[model samples]
Target: MLASVAAGLASTALGGAASAEGGGVPALQLITLTGPGTSGGDTGPGELLARQDAVLAKVGNPTTTYRWTTALNGFAVELTPEQVAVVESDPEVASVEANSVRPMSARRTPVPSSAQVRQPRATGGAGVVIGLVDSGLAPESPLFAGVPGLGRGPKDFAGSCEVGEDWPATTCNRKVVASGWWVAGFGPERIRSSEHLSPRDAVGHGTQVASVAAGNAGVSVRMRGRTIGEFGGIAPQARIAPYKACWGAPDPRDDGCATADLVSAIDRATADGVDVLDLAVAGPPGTDTVERALLGAAEADIVVVAAAGNDGREEYAAHGSPWVTTVGASLGSVWQGRVSVVGGPTLTGASRSRRTSPPTRLVLGADAAAPGATRRHAAQCRPGSLDAAATAGRAVYCERGGIGRIDKSEAVALADGVAMVLGNVRPGPVVDDFHAVPTVQLSAPDAQRLTRWVRSHDRTSIRMSGVAPSPVAGRTAAWSPSGDPRSSVIKPDVVAVGDGVLGAVPDQRGWAMFGGTSAAAARVAGAAALLRSRHDWRAPVVRSVLATTAVPLGTESVLRQGGGRAGADVRGARLALVVRTPRYREVLESGSWGDLNQSSVLVRATGSVTRRVTNLGSRAEYFSAQAIGFTRHRVRVTPLAARLSPGETATFRITVTGPSTPGHVDDGWIRWRGARGSVTRVPVAITR
Candidate 1:
C-alpha cells in the first residue's frame, strides 16, 4: 500500500503539560541590559553595587550581573521586555534590547512513504560506504559483517583515554590525536585515548542508528530483546564508516564542537569514497554553517541525508536546505489504531491530585484530538473534560512534557479507566504509549474541538475513516525534524520504517527496537547501496531518481508527499528500450535541461540484437520505438543508473527504430524523455 502525508498535531490544554520542563514553560533566555555610564569607568566594587541598586529600583528587582570582561565591558542586567522598557526609559539607561534569547530547537516533519521508495527490486548496492556521525559506535555490529573493502576503523573526534568499550575518562592519550571533546560540566575538553581504541558507543544512540543503516537481517545479537526490546535496522546489508562527533553527556550545552567537526566528517566521508552519508544530529535552526557543509557534500555528489530533529515543531532550516534529504518521525503501528484519554476527571489544585474513574467506551477518530478543557489547578473535571471523556472509554489526551508522555500514558492505562493517551504539541498529536492499550495522538486544535463538543452536548462522538494502522507517507515521526512554514521548504523528504526497528547494539547483543529518523535514514542508505551495486550513479542523481519515482500519500497534495514514497523496484530500475528517428528526438528534447535524460529503446526479444543504446547524459532521457514480430519481455540491464553519474555508461535494452523505408534508408535515433531530453543517432544497417 502507498503511504499518505498529513499534519500530525497534538491536542490538549495549555500549561505545564505543553511545556518542556519547569512547570511546562520553555527555557527563558537571559537578556543582558546596559545603561549609559555602565561601561565608562573602572568603578570600584562599592560604585558597582550602588549602580546595581539603582538599576534594580528602576526595573523592579531585575537580575544583576557583576562579572565584567573585555568582551562585555558594561554592567549587565537580565530582564524581560517589559522590564527592559522600564529600564530604558530611566534617565540613566543608555540602550536595551535582547542580548540573548532562548530560540526554538530544530524540528522536522516526516515525508510520506511515497517519498521513501518507489518500487521493490533486488539491485546491487549491498556493499557501499555509509558514514555515521554521532556518538561513539560499537565496532562489532552485525551490520558491518562481510562488507567488502571496508576501510580503517572509526576515528574519535573527542579525545578520551579509556579506549576499548569504556565510558569517557579524565586521563589524556598523547598518542591519540584529539579532534574535539565535550566534558560533563565544562565545554570542549581535550581527549586523550590510544591503544587501538575501538569505537565504543556508551550512549547506544549511534550504534542503534548504524544498525538501522546496515544491520544484517534476522541476525539476533541480543540485549533488550524480550519484554519491551527487540532489534533490527533498515538496511541489513550495507557497511558503515563511523565518525564520533557527539561526546560528553547528552546535554547540548556541554557539547560545543560546533560545525567544524561536522564539516571535517563530510570531507572524510568523501575522501573515503563512501556511497551514502547519514547525519542523525541537528543544530539550531537558521544556522548557515551546517547548511553550507551539507551543500558542499551534495555538490561533491555524496548523497547527504540528515535527521529532521525530534523537536515537535517545524523542520529546521539547516535540514531544509535543498541539498540534503531531511527525515521526520511517525508513530509505529503499536499506537496508531488505539484510543486514549485523560485517565480521570479534572480536579482543582496545584498538585495533580485526582481520583480514578471507571473505564469508558472507545471512540474512533484520527490519531490526533481536538483541544479543549484548560487545566485549572492540577485536577478538575469540567463538563467536557478529557479525563471525563476517557473514563467513558474514549481515548485520553495529554500534552508534550519533558518526561516522555509514553510512560505517562502507560501509567494512566494501568489505572484501569483510560484506554490510550494522545500527545498534543506544536507539530501535532503523537501516540505516547504507557501500556498495551491502543493509543492515537491528535493536534491541539483538534483536541480542543473535541473537548468543546463534549462540553456543549453531554456526550461527544468522533468517527475516523481512511487508512488506520497503516503507515503514513511524509508524516514526520516524533523524532524527525519539522519544516518551517515561513521558509516554505518541506524537510525530511521522506520517512522509512524505523520504529521498533531491530538491529545490533554493543556487546554482540542483537535485535533492539529503535526509533528515530537515524534508523529510517539508514534504511534508505542501504537501499541506495543496493542501487549503487547495480548501476553507478552520483549521490544527487540517485536522490533525484528516488524522489521522482516516489508515490504520493494521504489526501493532501504533492507538497505533503514531496514526490512520493521510496520503493525498491528492480523492474522500474531497468532502462526502457525505444527506437526513434530525428523527428521523435525533436519532440522529446523540447524541455528544460538537467544532469540526466531518459530514452525508450526497442529491440527484437528473439532476434540477433547484441547491442543497445545507453544514456550518458546528465538528464533523464527516454526513447520510444516499434518492432515487427517482436514481443516485450523483461531483461536484465547492466550497470543500473544508481551506480552511474554523468559521463558514465550503462547498457540499456535494444529496440527496433522503425519500419524499413526503402528510398530514405531508415535510421534510428534515441530520444530523451522524463525530466529532460536529448537525441542521438545510432548507425543501423536494415535489409528488407
Candidate 2:
C-alpha cells in the first residue's frame, strides 16, 4: 500500500508538474483544533472559522476549502510541507493529518427474507432522514421518485440542493430531500469531463448505494430491456440527504473519496440533522479525522453505518470506530441461469441478465486468442485479446480476475461474441453484475467442467435459460473482510445481504447488480433508520438492538459475522461492557474495544468480563442467561436469572479459565431468554 501511494504521488507530480512552491508538493490536510466543546463553552461556526483563520494566517493562508464546525472542530485546507509544519506547531491545533483517498466499495435475506416484509411493520422509516456520504445520486432514476404519500420533507433537514445550468432545481424532491457535492479536496482540475459538478452520479456508485438505503418502494428493476422484479429500499419512505464526497478518476486507484471531502461531508451531514449516516466508502479503522467526525456525529444522536470492506478476510476490517455500526457483506441465493452444454450435463450459474439467445457454438477464449496475445490473457478475455473471427458467432468462455467483470463482458461484446460464460478462479460467492451481453457466472467447479468439455468435444453448442435455483443461500460473502484482530471489539457488528443487490444506476442503464460491504452497510443503514423512526431510540440503543436481535446466518466464526445478520425487529437486552474510563472530554473515550457499549464482547484468554444489560421495554421482564459454543475453556455466567422493571439495568460476569495456547481462539454467544418470548444474544470472543 505504501509503495502504491508513492507511485501515485510520483505519477501526480509528473502529470501536474508540481514542485516545491512552499517547500514541498501541494497536499491537502485536515487541521484539528481546540474549539467548542473541547474545553467548556460552546463555540459557534463563526468563532470556529475565526479560530481556523487565525491559525491559517500564521502559515500565509494556504487555500482553505472546507470548514468543519459541527461534527469536527477543524477545517480542511491545501498546504505545502512548510505551511503544515507551522500549523502543527500552533497551540490551538490538536493534530494535522495529510488527506488521503479511499475507494467506494447488498441485497436480500438474513435481515428478514426481504426488506419488503419489514417495511409495513416499521412504517417504512417515516419521518427519518438518512444521510449518504458517497459518490453522488442519479436524480433521474425512478427509485428517487417522490411517492404520493411521502408527504413533506423533514422540517429539521438543513441540507440544500445546488442548482446549475445542467442540474436543474427540481433534482431534489420529497424522496431526495437534500443533495450536495464536494470536489475541492479532489482538486477541481482533476475532475473528469464524465464527472458532474452537481450532486449527480456519473460513476453510478452513489446511485446504487442510495437505492439500497432509501429508494422508493416497488420500483421495477430493469437491465438491458429485461424486467427482473420489483424491489425497494428497506426504509422506502425515509428522506435522503445525499452528500457526494467520492469521485471517479481515470486511474482505478485515484477513484476514491478524499479524506478532506469525507470529513466535510460528515460534518455537514451531522449539521443537517440526519437521523442516520450511511458511509459506504472503505477506510482505515484508526481514529483519524473521519473517525473523529463520525464520533461527533454519534454524540449528536445520529446513527452512523459503515462498510467493513471488500478486501476479503485476509485484511483487517475498516471503520472500526466503536460508535459506528460497521456491517459486513453476506451473499444469499441469487437468481441463476441454467446452461445446457449439448450432449453434456446441464449446470447453473449466477446471472441477472435473462435474455434468451439461440444455441450458439462454444468457443474457448484460448482458441480465439488474437495473434501475440498470451493464452492466459485470452482466457481472462483481456480487451483486444480475442480474434473477431473466432469469437464473432460463439459463446465465449472467459475467466474471472485480472480485470473488471463488466470490462470482460465488454471485451466479448467488442469481439462480437453472442454470449459470455464467466467463471470464477475459485469456489466462492458468484456475483451478478450488469453486463454488455447475456452473461452467466459459474463457480470454480462448474467452470472447470465446462472448460474441459469445451476443449475436448467437437461441435459443442450451448443453450441458456434464466430459470435456475441458486447454489448457495445466505452465507458470508467471499470478499467481505473479517474483524480487525488488533482491536478486541469484534468488528462488522452484523452481516447483511450484499451480493447480487439490484439498484439504480445513472443514464439509461436504469439498474445494475452491486456487491460489496458497501451495499451491506446501506442495508444496515436503512434498517437503523427504520428502528430509529419506529422507536425514536438513540444511536447506541439502535445499534444494540440490531446486534442482539440479529439471527445467526450459519456456523461462521464471530470475527466474520460478528452478531450475525442484521435484524429489523428489536427483541434483545442492551448490553454494554462495564468499562472504568474517564468522562468523555471533547472526543469519545478511545479505550479498550471491550469497553465499548455494544452487544458483542471480546476477552483475552483466562479473563473475566462484566457487562451491563438494560430492558428497553415498558413492562417488567425476567431473563435467563446461557453460554453456548465455548470449548477448551470453562465459562460461567453469574446470576443466571434477572428480573428487572422497565428501563432497569443489571450486571453479569462472564468468567473464563483455560490453558492459553498461542494463536488459539474461542467464541460463543451469551444468550438471554426473556419470559415474553423475546431473546437477546451477544457474541463473545476469547483470544490468546
Candidate 3:
C-alpha cells in the first residue's frame, strides 16, 4: 500500500480576484512579425536569418526590436505598440497584439510544520547547482552569505552596466545585445538603493519564492515563520544563480522581461551547468517561446519545475514539459482560523469583528449568519439568493465552481448586508482564502443545513467556532498539474508544501508569503539535490526514482497529484541500479599452444563491486543467456536461470560450447529483455 498525506483542508467558497487594481498598468497589444516556414525546404540557420532580416526590415527601427520564436517556423519579432500598427500594414506581417504579459501573484500554499510527519534527513545538495532565472540576485543578502563554490557573480544578460545593489532600481541596458533583448511590460525600472539589479520585490513574491527552494529558513529572519515561512525549502545547502527577467515597476516603458531575454537566460543556465531550474512564470497555453525554453531545458537534462498557476480557473495553461514538475497548493493548519457569527432575537445593533479562536466542539444550526458559510463558485449559489443573502446581513452558501472566490467576496461586500459566506463542503476539510472578510467554508452537509435554515425562517441566528490545528502529514494540495489526458505519462511527478510559504524578500528586513506549484517545484528540486548528494545519479535516474517512489495521494486517478509523495528513497533508487551494472569487461588468456587445435584454461573475473541498495529497492532481478556459433550451436550452463536481489547473492555459470573451425570462441550472454540490468555480452576465449 502507498503512503500519502491526506488532502489538506478544502478552500472556502469565495470568489477569485485579480491583482489589486492600480498597481501596474494592464498589458497592451504590440506589433507582431512572422518568419519563414520551418519545414524541410527552409530548415537551417541561414533560412532563419534571412527570414529575421526580412521581418526586421519591414518593421523599421523605432524604440526597440524584440525577437521571439514560434514552436515551428522561424523567428517572430515583437515591436512597440506604435510599431504594431505599422508592422500590420506591411505585407509580410502575420499578427499583432499587446505583449503577452501577466501579473505575478501568490498561488502555492505553505505546509504547516504539524503536517510534516517525517523530516527528511539533511542530504548534501551543496554540489548541485540551481539557477534562479528571475530579475537578479543580491550578493549581500543573508540568503547568499558565506555560501561556498558560488558559480560566478550574476552576469548581465540584459547587458546593463550600471548594476544596482538593491531591488526595482536595478536597470538593464536595452541596446539589443547579441543574445538578450528588452521588450515592454510592467514592474520596476530604475535600480533601487540596494545593490541587487533584480526588480524591486515590492510585491515581495519572487524573493519569497527563491528562498523557498534554496534559502535556509530562520537564517533570514525578515521572512517570518509562517508554516510557509523560514522552515520551508527542500535543499538548504544548494547554491542559487539568479537571472533578472521581470521588473516590478509601474512604468509601461520599463517593466517586464522580453522573450529574447528569457531564452538567453535558459542558454546561460544550461551553459553554466545548473542542476535545477525553477520558473515561477506563466503565459498563454499554446506553443510559445516560453514553452520552448522549458522544452530546451528538458533536452539539456536539467530538471525544470514550474507553477501550475493560482487563478482558481482550470482553463489556464500550465508550465508544462516532460522534464518540468508542476506543483499545486493545499491547506495548512497554521493558516486555518475559525470564525463565529452570532445573531439572536434579543440582539440589536450588534457589530461583530472577525476573530481567531481555539478549536472547540462547535455545534451546527446554532446561528444563521455563521462564519463558515460561503462557497468558492458563484454558480453554486441558489439563483438570485447570493445577492439577497449579501444584502440582508444573512450568511451565503454557494457550491464550488469555475468562477473565482474573490469575485464572490467582492459581490458580497457590495451587497452591504451579508455577514459572511460559506463554501460547499468536500470530503476533506476546507480552507479559507487570503481575504479579510468574515468568510467560512463548511462541509457539504453543513452547507445544506444553513441553506435549509435560512429558507425555513425569516429571522434566523447562527454561531460557529472551531480551531483547526495542523496535521502530522502535509495535506496533498490539488494545484499540481497532472499528466496529459491523452497520455498517462505523469506530468507532475511529485508534490510538496507550497501554500502560505514564507521566505526572503527584496529588502533586507522584509519577508513575504508565497504559494503555488512554483514553490513546490523548487522543493522537489532541492529534494533531488539531496538524492544526488547521497548517490551518483543523473537527471533521468533521479527523475525515475522520484516518480516510482512517490506515495499515492489517494485512489483518485487525477493527474495533478501524480505518482504521489516525494522522498529520498524515490530519488535515489534508479541511479543505484545503473551503478550496479557492469559497464566494462576485461578478458585474460591462460596458455598459448602452437599445434593444439583447442585449449582449456581457467577463467576468473576482477572488478569493483558496489552494493548500496536500500530496502525500497531490494526486489528480485532476473537474468538470461544465449550463445551463438559458426553453425547455430547451443551452449549449456550450470545455472540455467536464477533470481538475485541486489547485493545478496552471486551465482556462477559455466557454458560448454559446440564449435567448428579454429578462429575464436565467443560465449554470448543475454539477459531478460526488459529487466533492469539486462545485457548482452561476448566472452572471448581464443584457441591455439
Best by lDDT: 2
lDDT of 3 by residue, 1-688 (tens): 0000000001001001111222222223333334322211235545655555665565452222233332222233333444455556866554544445554435523432222212323334655666665555433445545444332332322222222234222222111011111222321234233323333344355556656666642452421222321343466566565654555454433334545445545645554556667766655554455655564455455666665565634533365443455555434434243334334221111111235332222222222132344432233442222444334454444454445544454545454434344445455445544332345665566556555555666654454333444342344555544334332123344566656555566664555455666555666767766665555555545554554445544443334444455553443242122111111000001122111110011111211111122222346666544432313234444444445564444333444444443433222222222156433222212121
Q: Which candidate tops TM-score? A: 2
- The best-first sequence of candidates by lDDT reads 2, 3, 1
Model 2 CA lDDT for position 94 = 77
- lDDT at 429, model 1: 31
- Record all residue pairs in model 2 with backbone atoms less than 3 Å apart, i.e. clashing: 106-498
List, residue by residue over 639-677, the lDDT tens digit for candidate 1: 222333434344544334345433222222222232343
Residue 100, model 3: lDDT of 50
- Ranked by TM-score, the better of candidates 1 and 2 is 2
Per-candidate clashes, comma-separated: 162, 1, 87
Model 3 error, position 12 (Å): 46
Q: Indicate the residue-level lDDT of 69 in model 3.
A: 33
Alpha-carbon shift of residue 681 in model 1 (angstroms):
29
Q: All candidates' TM-scores? A: 0.44, 0.78, 0.50
